[model samples]
Target: MNREKTYGIGELARDFDVTTRTIRFYEEAGLLSPAREGQQRVYTDADRVKLKLILRGKRLGFSLSESRDLIEMYDPESGNSRQLNALLSKIQERREQLNEQMREIELMQVELEEAEKRCLDAFDR
Candidate 1:
């Protein structure tokens, strides 16, 4: 007889380098659904994969809702085309947002430089 691999909450937290509270928070948010073995939470390989994706999404600046949507959209039956397309669209949107922020930061830096020059000129007089 073969048994399926399982993980405890603490084991997952250690493996993912996250706090147990974080895992619980994700569970509360409906991101992870681990089976309960009495008082202990038992996570399957699928749960582990979801946790990995959630962390990856967080690193890529995705909001929890966005990550949830993407994760929920996943369908291995259809080759995950829709999920991939949506992810690409989101990536594009994020890139555009970052570009806009960069432009704003550049403008602010120029203004600061001008202000500093004016102050230095006043001091020199």
Candidate 2:
């Protein structure tokens, strides 16, 4: 009669492949609201889902504040068209930044290849 999935902070970190400090930071950010089992922090499945979303948002190049706003807007209890529009604008901005970075990376790749070829030619001299 004790099968409720409540993970300790260490277990949660291992399960999520993140640091305990990361979980703590999310807690500090109000993204995770874990309960305390004595001196230990125990995370619920809902907290885990929020962590997953936060990490995914980070991977997608979202700032913490922007990601938080997006998630807050996405909540059924708090969903608003205006907030959705703000999130969409953030997505668009991220896409544009990514496009610019990709262009710079391509240019760097070409330059590196050219430099490598020149070095190889010098070795042949």
Candidate 3:
């Protein structure tokens, strides 16, 4: 018979390249809920997957609440329509925000270049 694997807090922290405190913070944030054995936290494969998803969401610039909502939409028994739609919405919003920031950056760059030209012209006098 084959048995499922479980991990200790340290093992998960190492595998994910995060500190134990980070894991604890996730737990406190209701993102993870590892089982307890005395004082030790025992993590299941589900927990590992959740942690991966959380990191992926963060890397994609998602807020913790957004990550939590996306995670919560997963249900093995149901369709993923809601999750996909929500994700698409978030992506669109992020793209808009990034576009606005890019425009601002371009304007700032133009102003800096003009300022440099003025400074150089003054120096030549």
- Which candidate number would show the highest TM-score if scored against the true structure? 1
lDDT for each candidate structure: 0.97, 0.85, 0.93
lDDT at 102, model 1 = 100
The C-alpha stretches of model 3 lying farther than 4 A from their native spots are none
The predictions' CA RMSDs to the true structure, in order, are: 1.0, 3.3, 1.3
Candidate 2 TM-score to native: 0.73
Looking at model 2, how many pairs of residues clash?
0
TM-score of each: 0.94, 0.73, 0.92
Clashes of 1: 0
Clashing pairs in 1: none
Tens digit per residue, CA lDDT, model 1, 8-100: 999999999999999999999999999998999999999999999999999989999999999999999999999999999999999999999
Tens-place lDDT digits, model 3, residues 29-100: 999999999998999999999999999888889998999999999876667888888999998998999999
Cα lDDT of model 2 by residue, 77-125, tens digit = 6557777788679889999999999999999999999999999999999
* Candidates sorted by TM-score, best first: 1, 3, 2
lDDT of candidate 1 at residue 9, scale 0 to 100: 96
